[model samples]
Target chain A: MAMSDLYREHILDHYENPRHHGTLADADFSHEESNPLCGDHVRIDVKLSEDKTRIADAAFSGEGCIISQAATSMLLESVMGWRIDDVEQLDPQHVLSLIGVPLTANRVKCALLGLKVLKTGIKLWKLQQMQHSA
Target chain B: MHTQREFFDVHAVRRDFPILQQRVNGKPLVFLDSAASSQKPLPVLEAMERVYREAYANVHRGVYALSEAATAAYDEARAKIARFIGAPAVENIVFTRNATEALNLLAYAYARAFLREGDEILLTELEHHANFVPWMVLARERNVTLKFIPLTPEGLLDLDAFERLLTERTRIVTFAHVSNVLGTITDPAPIIARAHAAGAIVIVDGSQSVPHMPVNVQAMDCDFLVFSGHKMLGPTGIGVLYGKRALLEAMPPFLTGGDMISYVGFDDVRWNDVPLKFEAGTPAFVEAIGLGAAVDYLSALGMDAVRAHEAQLTAYALERLSEVSGVRIYGPQDPQRRGGVIAFTVNRIHPHDLASLLDQHGIAIRAGHHCAQPLHQRLGVNATARASFYIYTEPSEIDALAEGIEHAKRALRIS
Candidate 1:
């Protein structure tokens, strides 16, 4: 318990010195995802590519416990260059495995915060596409 | 622990709650959320067990041996609750599913009997939804106004706001004896006095107080008081609502069925006595007995000791959590006037993360809106982490919580 495999130094480094923690409100699409249970909220913006094949640029703004904010920050970094298919197929295990196994049953939601926001953004993008087609 | 300190011994009291023996993740159960619902002691469980084993029959309807025994036990349980809360008589004690249901009963009976257009129901900003929603729905139905007593800067009830809100139009003054979130104990005497002077009936939601502190319906002099058995270490689906005799007699029954009517023939009926007039169906006999046992058990220890123990534990928890940098505690920061409930949010870390980290160490706490959505909104947070304590809680558990929180901070990489 003393040496947590779940909370690695890298996670701490990313959490303490967060990258791209602000927002891009001028971006094409912005969505907010919040878990009311634990007071975790993330506002995400995406400037989608004209082709819609890959995410062009992404940035996030949020305040939560470390798991939520860091996971969100890392997730934004992880998905920026990847295609929609790659992002959709991207397993949360990859994110969790990297962080180590310090999570208990209830804490899984915090660790999974990034994945929820990323998925929600993708869903909102698809909805917007349908709206334009109509 | 000064109040009733000589009546009970803490070491002897620890052995009563069986849940303490259980191990989770190879550690003893460090339960810190009794406000949610307390674990049952052996006495309560056995009371229910003994009823099922020896006397298992429906009450008030049957005349056989088992039926008579069951009816007697049920009535005896009501009498016990009446004695426990210092109710004027057993007839004033009406059993409902829980405190929520007891409050609902008031709404149903009052809506039918007293409510009308332009009436107002006065409530506080710091109320659990159970206490909030019933009155809200009632206000909607009666086309009445639901006025809230503004909270003080420190999360206590703004007594001036409460006094100012009262008018001839105010039908009821509803408030919690002790806030479930803040644990701030309100001296309900003056509030009840003001409400009565304004011709407004008073309803005290005693779910939080009856379990931890001594309550006398006569002394409080409120129109009604409601509390749940489960929150006080009894079985669920059982609660007590004590109304003044005149008030109980005047209000219409909330439900209609057999046993509540004294005479029924050809579409004509006469309702039964005071308490039975409200309890319409087959009552929770076993649970009622268990609640009686729970009342006995808590009384044996004494409310004064329980309050003192919780005060010490709450102070310890507040002191420890405050020591951690970047931790923002909620509710009244002063621990002396507060009960054992403490809610906090760690900077750069989510409450879910803190809860999960603590769970691994077998320390249990509550996180989220905690059914007190308004308080969360007032604090300008959507959610927070809460840890509540009871008689069995130990100082070591607080240390464990602190240790677990530190681990969460490091793991999340928050300062």
Candidate 2:
């Protein structure tokens, strides 16, 4: 019943001043998604390494609840130096734990919207690369 | 205003709703979401149970004792609802799944059949999706133009704009009796008269209004009125689509199957009477009986008093919520011009976050676009947190809501 359980200090800090929050012009992969229920929108633009295996830089641009905006900010920080394979393996549970809150059944979607956009963007990027190499 | 406080025993009324007597998240359950779906009273719950246990049978076909009793109960339920809305006759009431289905029926059967090409269907910017989408679909299919009566900056419908929109090409005029998000109680008298003068049929979406106030279709003089049962303390899966007897008679059947036709042949068919023709297949008999009980419950309490109670609560909520910093409320400032629904936003606190924090204290409120995306677009807010009230809601709950907003601000670390 603690209010702090859902809106912790770290979440609000990241939400107030998000890290790496803007669209990328030199982006290799980009995707935008919105939660149909609450209309919380998030877009993730990722730049890849020259070798095309790791995420060199990541940025996000959108407006939403603290769980979503802060989640995207924290997600960008975590995935910047990650391999594409590791980013692809990021699941909903990992995103929820990163949010550091006990989200209810309904608010889980708000917390994971950024991760969903990133995973989808990476998947689409991998598909395009497969077609090019073929 | 002080005399209105004695209208009802809110504590006694709260006891009648058994679902409200429970605890959630280690706190007493504070239900502020009555506009979504009201909790049922004991009489309403027992009414449906009595039907299933005692008079369980298919209506209209069997001549046995059980079937006869079931048929009588179902018929009486229809009559009670017909009386509840001040319909001219029972034949005017057509049962549907919910308000959405009833509106779909009107759009498909009435508008599609009567209106011709290049006609206009005038709607407002404050409509819920149920009232807005069906007409849009009908307009697209029938090659009719669609126009909107825009809203003022304060969220009232622009009556001047509405008059200008009511040209000879306007074939139908429809709007919500009370906006679900903004809670604006629009006066339909002028609009109804103007539409009728232009020879256009007027349909009123009373899903929000009928549950909170006394509505007289004859007084409103609209051609058709639509509302749902679940939002008004009845069970789900039952609603009423009330039209004038003549209009329903002229309209063709929207759905076709068993119980809707008098006789059938491979080459030709004979449809049943006005209301039954629109109602296809087996109806929700138990739910209808439950709705009848809901009408009885509301009638015993009196609709005027029910409305007064909500007005008092809304005024209190508006006053109390204003005390909380950064809480911006939508809709008219006058309590007389609105319902118990309040859609609001807190500065730097997303509705989802506020709603989540409130749930910890066992306060339930809706946080979303509320099925009115276009209205939200017009209001320029992605989402809002809505707290709606009914008879059981009290001024104490309003205090809790304000305190909850403060708690949310503290939790979010906002100064």
Candidate 3:
């Protein structure tokens, strides 16, 4: 594939001007993950609605390749107002589609790093809640 | 003074490497990733093929002619490697899978056998993971302390800091001869001398230096030296760990099963001699033979000429790469103090992105930490793209790399 295809205009735009590219001070849950191979890092913070059933807002911060940083920006933008349940159900294919390009095996990790951080944080937060209620 | 151009013709030498003739992405291949692994020359490849075709058999076993031939070739390879590195004897060279495995062997057999709690292992920030991780594991297991010799702002190891770090508790001093990322060449002679005075055994990771320059283990007086075959125009699956005679004899075997044992009884077994004591199972005899041929090729070219050629290329590369805007080259600016490897970052472009863009032009480089994360952490950068040179590398490839960086900058809309 051409280099341009991988770094498309939208991808470059998201990289240059990332959306939701900061942390929320009162985030309900936050988690960070890194690709050890390339040292690409992504930390995701989520704020739930008052009822605590929907993602009212989300933000991501990290340093990495264009695909990683851009994909994280796009991911955070799309998951705004998403139900907590639906966000939990978010799969890798959805993230790949969001990327809108075929990624090599190495790059798939970069493109999906945000989703991993988001899902892992929610899962850990849910476990904490269960422990507290019990 | 003889010039490299007068003595060594890079174009003629390039013909020895078959892979260099290929076209990738519709452009001539500009392989600048020799620091990762070098391309095999024809002599090395032919030697390996000839061995498999003519004398294919398990070594040190059968009494048949084929086995004997295989054993002879393998033994000769060890001798050639021993001579290549100025080792005292052939018994000092132990074959392992690669440089990583060789380091692990030393960690398990030497450090685990000798070190005690609170014993210090002085390493540098410039080590590759192969040199770093094994010792780190040993520190965890043996309750040892790992101290690092810091790097100067220019990326050279601070010898004064090294002197201060060496204490009575320092049991081992291990470091890379050349930094894979920064291209800094640490002179082993003084370090070895000081480490010896401090009662620390020195292990030199010569993976990057051995291929690009002349390295004499005996002259350096390092306790152990480790290097891989693939990085020196040889086949993979072969590496060498050259240790002092007494040390190799003192250390226990790291891996044990076959060949390494002198005899096996129902309840007891006796270990073999020093070199074979370390080499277990069916070894990579063919690869070793190929490595022998690689040594022959390099010797024929003369290592002095090889070093001169790379020095010239490194100087030219540093000059050309500096001309490009937003390019920040790492390591010593002077090529005399470093290897042929050049690691740099361009503007705000991520190394992976830069590598991908360069790949489109058929220019291969290493991106990311290059397995030197601690050094990168010290540099305060996540990653840098690296371009390394070899005997066959040309000045035009460096020109291509400089041009390719411009193309990458333009594509990413970086002004």
For candidate 2, the chain B TM-score comes to: 0.98
Ordered from best to worst TM-score, the candidate numbers read 3, 2, 1
Prediction 3 TM-score vs. true: 0.97
Superposition error at B393 for model 2 (Å): 0.8
lDDT of 2 by residue, B1-415 (tens): 1233757888888899999999888888999998899999999999999988999999988999999999999999999999998998999999999999999999999988999999999999989899988988887888898899999988899999998889999889999999999999999888899899998989999999999999999999999999999999999999999999999999999999999999999999999998899989999988999999999999998999999999989988888898888999999999999999999999988898889889999999999999998999998999999999999997888888898888878777776
Instruction: Please provide, for model 3 over B130-192, each residue's C-alpha lDDT reduced to its tens digit, 9 standing for 90 to 100.
Output: 999999999998899999999999989999999999999999999999999989989999999
On DockQ, the stronger of 1 and 3 is 3
Instruction: Candidate 2: list runs displaced more than 4 Å.
Output: A81-89, A126-134, B1-4
- The TM-score that candidate 2 achieves is 0.96
Q: What is the DockQ of each candidate?
A: 0.45, 0.81, 0.78
* Tens digit of per-residue lDDT, candidate 1, span B298-321: 888888888877887887788888
Candidate 3's error at B220, in angstroms? 0.8
* Better candidate by TM-score, 2 or 3: 3
Model 1 chain B weakest lDDT span, ten residues long: B1-10
TM per candidate, chain B: 0.96, 0.98, 0.98
Q: Least accurate stretch of 10 residues (summed lDDT) in model 3 chain B?
A: B1-10
Off by over 4 Å in 1: A1-22, A26-30, A46-59, A70-105, A108-134, B1-7, B255-272, B316-328, B332-336, B346-348, B402-415
Better of 1 and 2 by lDDT: 2
